[model samples]
Target: MNTRPLLEVEDLRVSFPGTTGEVEAVRGIGFSLGREKLGLVGESGSGKTMTGRAILGLVPPPGRVTARRLAFEGRDILGLDAAGLRRLRGARIAMVLQDPKYALNPVMTVGRQIAEAHRAHGRASGREAERKALELLSAVRLRDPERVARAYPHQLSGGMGQRVMIAMMLAPEPALLIADEPTSALDVTVRTQVLAILDELVTARGMGLLFISHDLNLVASFCDRVMVMYAGRILETCRADALSQAQHPYTRGLLASLPRLDRPAETLPVLARDPRWLDDARADA
Candidate 1:
């Protein structure tokens, strides 16, 4: 069995033009991901989403992505040309975006979309692609696969749309799955169901998952390890179960800001920011 990491990043930076000058969205961040669930948690504008997009070659033009080393399963991501990146994406690596409505085609039926995804990467015959599309819908625990498959994107509920997106991403059986806030739009119960399906699929397939979200507690419970980001850099990383014990001031403050049911406070505590935390984020990590 191959023991190498599925993804490796070092000195990764993403920048864009600002009014004054170039503004770095993702500071120099580095980490390796194996075949396990790893959570990237941070507040809005912390560069969590930019980092994921950079890895998948989805960063829009005018955004500069640079790294000393950015590799996926031994291939240099930064060095890959457009065609190479396109071939790599959806086949070797798949991303489940935050909103399925926008990610999926509006005019196509769900079955055709999934079948297209499968056929695009897997090179399956028309009949085989359709069959696998239904199977994948069932795998995501979507009831009445046949009926759901025939429906359009707008016909499905939030949870059902998310499940279809997951099924679409899984069509190629990619080695790495980048799930960027896939559950953020769902209600609590539906979120739990989607997470359960993600867990089952990732575990069964031995796929590396880069789960990005702003929910620290949710990430702590769902992932094996966690990385806390702030101001475009990772401030701390630790076992997900031990995130409460994190020593970084930023991590601690973020945790304290959450309103816990057991702690019944009238108001949640506000997170206090320190300039030094940004300066020392790399060292802390």
Candidate 2:
């Protein structure tokens, strides 16, 4: 197994100016990723998404992002200008948002969008780009590539729309993919199907996958390693398969709060928080 680091992050932080004070969305956190699945699990506002956005240079205005180091393929991305960020985004690093309805263009046909993305990222164009679009659609495990490709965003089901988004992202053949709650909106069956496709793609393409989700169990099952995030900081990181053995109080609280079928409980316990975890720079569990 090639365990070389494909992406590196150090002392990453994101701040937004507030009326009262500066609000830190992502406190100083650090980690590295290779050609493997890394899951980030946290509450809605726990900085999981913020970390991804800062790394990609997608943080909106009034949102200040700083890091000691953020590099991909040994290249520092923090200094990338708008054009540099544009060139870096889809061609080298890609992000798959949870909702395809907002991610996909409602007016454009799916095939056109995918083909254009391919052409923009690479030198392929016209017939070649169109062919690559179909190929990508099929690669994403979507059936009837021709019919589906011709359909518009609103014409497809939620699952199909998400699949199309994945297909479009794959057009660039990105080395690192940030999948933020990619299957959260799908039904259980469709969720499984999409996850399977992602697993296959990651293994086949030898790319790094940064999976951000709130589903602790799902992340445990899917990813090789996991990072638990809280109030702008990573609470703990452990092998995904060994999440049940996590030592941090926050991670333990999270696991204890989940209802289990095998060991059923009358009520899930509320997670107890400690303020000290947020301030401790040495708290990497």
Candidate 3:
């Protein structure tokens, strides 16, 4: 087994040029991902998705992304040009965006979409691509894979849409999968099903997973490790089992804010904000 990390990011920074000045969205965050599930938990504006986008070189114009080290499968992605990044995006590292409604093409059949993704990285005939697409759909637990493949995105529910997205992402058999809130838009039942599909796929394929979301409890239960971010910086990083025992106040507050069925608090406590949590501790250390 290749024991080295599939994805490594160190001292990553993303800044946007605003009228007032520069606004740093990702202020020097570092973490590594192997062939295991890693969760990034934080509130909005914490740079979770931005960090994933930066990994794929998806940051929009006027936003600058810089990193001391950014590598995937031992290849340095930091300096990769557009063509190189495109090859790496779906072939080496695939991403599942938050909503499939926006991610999928309305006019294209689900099978065509997945087939296109497969063909993007390698050569495949139409029949071969369709066969692979149906197999991918089946892998994600989609019922009646052939029918689902022929259906359009609008014909499917949110959960099914997400499943199609997952199938497409998995079609190329990428080494790393970055899922940014892949289930956030679905209902509780659908969300669990979608997450389970993702978990099973990652485990079965031994692919590295970067699950980005603001739900701390989900992260705690689902991921091997959890990274808590605040104001574009990591507040704490610890094993999933140790999340409740996290040392940082910010992480503790986040865990406390979640509604727990076992504890059954009358009212969940509000998270207290602290500017000091965003300070660069690496410099002081």
lDDT of 3 by residue, 209-258 (tens): 99999888888889999888888888778888789998888888888888
TM-score of each: 0.98, 0.97, 0.96
Per-residue lDDT of model 1, residues 121-157, tens digit only:
9769999999999999999899899999999999999
Query: TM-score rank, highest first?
Result: 1, 2, 3
Clash count, one per candidate: 0, 0, 0
lDDT of residue 133 for candidate 2: 94
Candidate 2's residue-wise lDDT over 1-285, tens digit each?
Answer: 556588888989999999999999998999999888999999999999999998899999989999998998888999888899999999989999999999999999999999999999899858999999999899888889999999999999999999999999989999999999999999999999899888987888898999999999999999999999888888788899999998888888988998898888888899878888777443443
Shift in Å, residue 112, candidate 1: 0.4
Cα displacement (angstroms), candidate 1, residue 261, comes to 0.6
Count clashing residue pairs in model 3: 0
**Which residue pairs does candidate 1 place in steric collision?**
none
Candidate 1, which ten residues in sequence have the lowest lDDT sum? 276-285
Candidate 1 error regions (>4 Å): 283-285
Best by lDDT: 1
What lDDT score is found at residue 23 in candidate 3?
A: 98
